[model samples]
Target: AGITGTILILGHTDPLFLRELLEYRITQTVIDKAHGIQLDAAAAQAGQIPEVHLKIDSGMHRLGIDTRQPEDAAAMFALENLNITGIYTHLAATDSIAGEDIAYTRRQIDAFNGLLRTLQGMNIQIPLTHMQNSYGLLNYPDVCCDSVRIGASLYGMGSKEPHKSNVIIDLRPVLSLRARIVMIRTLEKGECFGYGMMFRADRKSRIAILPLGYVEGLPRKLACGRGTALVHGRRVPFAGLVCMDQLALDVTDVPDAKPGDTVTLIGRDGEEEIGIVDVAEAAETLHVEILCRIGQRVATVVIDE
Candidate 1:
């Protein structure tokens, strides 16, 4: 961390004591700022230190000091007590499934490069240049700088396999989403179920209700009025509009359904598996967006079998 006086800190840790860990960068600039901090001064007074890094917006435009204004860069250097270590940007559509946004991705990279040129004229040296996110690492290798940061793949998720010479490691999914059936109704020839009366009985049907629904992140787009679920090793189309806390599926074929029957919302039953990607394709969206929006109310069960 000290070789460059920059430590990428995530979450909520104070930067005051960080100076001590910057073993390689003990320059006076860092020492002075470390001591100047009002960080419970009396306690840290004995160990005042200051090696720091500031985030400059290259193109992400999400967080960091927007360098669009030269003053933003100037304001950062003006902080006499700190050292600017690195600058980075996040590409917006590098992971596009269509791969049609290559131009946009390259444009952002060019913008960041422009910022670097602008800073160099002002005598600012940005030691680390990183832009590649998981998507960037996979589809836009040109954006990888300093190091590559990976996330979705760490837990075995929707990352595209990169064609890089370095073998990409495959991670295992650490979670499984499961649910239980609350009730099973015998649908008479004219019965209807769920919100908006979306599912009408097509011939005496057996309907099973699961205590999970749109509230749990099931795509409401299923309102095309057709959806399905995994039931007893078979696929059952949803009978109607997915509700807030429950959904109904036609389980007539799965004659064994009962109040206590366990259902697989996103797993395999026998030789059938319902992955989120399949669900996303059906809903016409990327699996990443759908996974990110999964409601917090659902229990995240970690199982190994």
Candidate 2:
């Protein structure tokens, strides 16, 4: 990966962090809101200002200056020390293919363009401009200015349901999670399991205890037989509620399941595989949410193949 490009700091610039960025000659950054004069002062101290990209709130109503306010745009551009090299806006909802949401996204695009024209009217020439996130990159590719910020798509996830992107790139998942069975036990037909006695063995069943639980980022909904794990190339259901640091799976069907055996929470095991989308659907959430909420207690390993 021979890439040489500046990383965009998505949040408000802190003075201390700005100083370090300046020291490292990092030139690209997005100014989401007014950060007082400290930002300019820091850049001035470093002998040159960064190529600042002004973020306008086209309709997201989150972290950006209102595009309706021309004064805000002018004031930032007028800063003698900083160079307004780019202007960008975030899309609120680009996943809606039709109706009000799509119409609203169009309105935001119009507003963003208007803001660009307003800057141009004042003789301010921003060399680069972009307003697309992953959804916009897929749906509004023709509206691209200078560049598009593709976030989730880079990780092989789509913005909409059905898990297929409009973009032609053949995307593949880059991350997979796995865990090991730590213990195994047999439960009587009438025996209860987990907190609150939420689940009970319908018959004599074998349970495999895993070193992972909701606290380790697995959703509790996945417990109580709602989710399944791949053990010995077969799907096995959870025995009961997910605990804080551990969970139990009904491995009765797989007689080979043992303490040292590996369990695939989300990855390939033999001929079977569990994907992020499958886990997200089981948790009733988005894939990104599932990935983000993975607890810090779990270790991570990166693979290139």
Prediction RMSDs, each to the true structure: 7.5, 3.0
For all predicted structures, in order, the TM-scores are 0.70, 0.86
Identify the candidate with maximal lDDT: 2
Model 1 has an lDDT value of: 0.63
State the lDDT of candidate 2 residue by residue for 52-84, as single tens digits.
677888999987778888778778777777776
Pairs with steric clashes in candidate 2: none
Clashes of each: 4, 0
The regions of model 1 sitting more than 4 angstroms off are 1-71, 80-86, 97-100, 117-129, 147-149, 159-174
Give the top-scoring candidate (TM-score).
Answer: 2
Candidate 1 residue lDDT tens string, 1-305? 22553346422234454445444444222112223243224225435334444444555655555547655655555554455455556677766645447767777788777777887888876666677766677676655478666766554665534432133546456545678889888878887776677778878988888888888888777653355678788888877777778887788888888888888867668988877666777778866676776798998765666
Q: Model 2 clash tally?
A: 0
Tell me the spans in candidate 2 whose CA falls farther than 4 Å from its real position.
1-4, 23-33, 36-38, 41-51, 159-170
RMSD of 1: 7.5
